[model samples]
Target chain A: MSDEVKDPKDVLICRCEEVTLREIEQAIDEGFDTVNDVKRITRAGMGLCQGRSCSKVIARIIAQRTGKNIEELLQNSYRYPVRPEKFKIFDEEESHE
Target chain B: MGMSTAYYLTLQGKRVLILEAGIFGAGASGACDDMILFQSKKPGINLELAFESLELYHALNVDLKHDLGFENYGGMVLIKDQKELEIMEEFVQQQRMYGLDVVMLDEKEMRKRQPHISSRFIASTYSPMDAQIDPFHVMYGFFHVAKNLGLEYRKKTPVVGIEKQGNGDFRITTQSGEVFEATQVVNAAGTWAGEIAAMVGENVPITPKRGQIIITEKIPMVGETNLWSAEYLVSKLRPEVKTEISEEHKALGLGFAFTRSFGGNYLIGSTREYAGFDTRTTMEGVNAIVKQAVSYIPLLKDIHFIRAIAGLRPSTPDGKMILGEHPDVPGFYTASGHEGDGISLAPITGKLLSDMMCGAPSDSRLEELSPVRFAVVKGEQVQ
Candidate 1:
């Protein structure tokens, strides 16, 4: 399966952020194994989707590379406003309530 | 703070070990923005140390062999009214005398640099010296390099107790009941520095100032340089200049700092509230920050904010970082209470603390930043 892609750099894991598999691998090689660490260094999951799209794939990649259990790796915290939110919404009269 | 100090110590050929209460970058180091601002600093030791720190960052970018994401993206402090302009003009003059390349820009110049800025801002102060670096990269760069140089670290090992042994060595007990001994112990704990100092019977007044920042989705660059409002600085520098500030804004301690990250997201911030140790992002803070940011750059109003992060900045009473050895506690040192300037001053703090520990001839100017200022001398507190 790994041989299917001759170059990990060509594999785009995070479509929202346009992060490639090679970038994630490089981050892991540099000792940023956790999803959050890689997310910070590579911006793989910090985009419009906020890791919803690429976190699992990145975790699997880390697990495969680092030989760590997928469950053992701490996941990034799920933050508020589950979807993308506009700044004006907060200023709305209803949001204040 | 601990990691960078450890890195510097390792560079000095000292056997260093770091005991962290949590994982790396779990605290303010990870949660804060990447600004290494110069305009925000008062023209004093803080500014002096910031200049030295920026130089060190350039060297570290090469020495660490990693992209620290260091960028010389200049900064601007927007002035809203005649009152703010008056204060900022004097402030800029003082900074200019201190060798900072800063200038007061008219509304035309400000708009030429930041087209998205609201027309309400009458003027701004621009400084090309203002810069930023990715905190995570810098932190981990120190960690990896120092580890390669024989530095050891134990994550999740919170120091539960500290005691001086009869043999003059310091004994440290971790939360996991592990014991370690060292001849010298440096308290590089951020907000928890006070607690760590108390364990050794030293007094260090470090409070946690909660700063909340919101992240926007990847978008086009709104301005040429990082942005800050003189309104916040006015309130801090000249409290006599009465301006209509909302109760919500006051409570949240809302301010504006807008910077685009390497990944192209605008890291808009922030609030400065004395919320103790609560690092939770409040709805009020997020709303205030968004409103303040939109007021400065109306283009941000339509942007989608994806996440809100809060960090507890280790604030001191005087706003200067506490560095140097305790007066009575020999072999004990502290390098904390940097508050918002932690990222800006991390490298210099580490180098200076390491130099102090190594008994190297140090700068006399650093005497002003000593922890001895907070020490109780003969039942009389020293200012």
Candidate 2:
């Protein structure tokens, strides 16, 4: 909430995708307004871990850059199998037949 | 829908083989919030189809002999403000026109029905037709019965290619190089229907509208009926209507829908984002869902959201489903693009498609649902 200019490049924004603050800032500068928008353009929150690990960090960076509350930023919806599961589970269940 | 179609097809003494691109219920069918509520439908054919589907759900467990974990505990739509309450007044009238048994409840009556609902709600609507089921179990039951009746289903066998044979039959190939020739090919591919149609040289306008849901850890029951916000009705039924809150919520694609699973866990959702195929969850989506849920049910603030998942509702340009045969492709038919209503409309879709394939009297609804409704053959405007 302070006006002190800090280096956005020094920090990591999305740990899941290994996206840095500099990349996130560049994504914002390129006209990505929302968190989901930045994630799509820069792959900041899209990763194997499903963004649960680093989405908040990315949101905060966007909130700071946009001078808006983090609540105003849009979040990407999570996809299925919240964690990784084997595809063989699909085949394994059929063996019950 | 595919499994149910197989069940009906087998009953009509036809050889049926189901080729699933993934495990059963792995798509929208599995990821739904288990709302079989008639209150959600718009009036006219939509409500009539929903009422018909409700009747089918009543008989599905007995017919399948699978129990299905079905429950008719009823449901409620929470109205947060006067604007949303006004919308519900008209929505309830439309539902009533279709003979739905629903009653509007003020804060006192609503509180009597579900005391845990936050005091912010001015009114609510309750309906007995609103119910819940384990979506996976429903498909599994259909598959189990259809299988016993000599139906063959192959999971993970996606249709990689669909070539029209000279004899007017279709040769379907899987990703693993397995091939089979069929007299007719049904495309019940759900959200992937667009891609499947492309394989057969057809274009179906299906957008993967991503919806996110959160499952809280199981606990003692908080309310007796499934609860959704009137905001949800506006979002689903009338997204173009704008207000200050609705406009703000639209940015996050947040609509408040919540239901308790049969196991006592709360399944809270859901955000409608046109994010293409990216189903991964975002921090803002989760936060907005939590904020919407806790705003209506303050008690949920303490609950732990143990799991989060998303499903792509196979949305069409218009809200109606895409069904029936390809106009140009002789043996190719489609039964996909049910969107959020896939779970509710599955039985009806299956029965309808089966009747058409059996050369029986096609349900009048097929006239509207046919894939040619998009009219790519005539090279006309796409709906």
- Per-prediction TM-score: 0.93, 0.78
Tell me the spans in candidate 2 whose CA falls farther than 4 Å from its real position.
Answer: A1-97, B235-241, B246-248, B378-383
User: How displaced is residue B90 in candidate 1, in Å?
Assistant: 0.9
Q: Name the Cα RMSD for model 2.
A: 15.9
TM-score of chain A of each: 0.80, 0.73
Q: How many backbone clashes does candidate 2 have?
A: 7
- For candidate 2, lDDT tens digit of each residue in B208-250? 9889887776568777888877876775666676755656568
What DockQ does each listed candidate score?
Answer: 0.63, 0.03
Best by lDDT: 1
- TM-score, candidate 1, is 0.93
Clashes per model (N, Cα, C within 3 A):
0, 7
Scored against the true structure, residue B93 in model 1 reaches a CA lDDT of 96
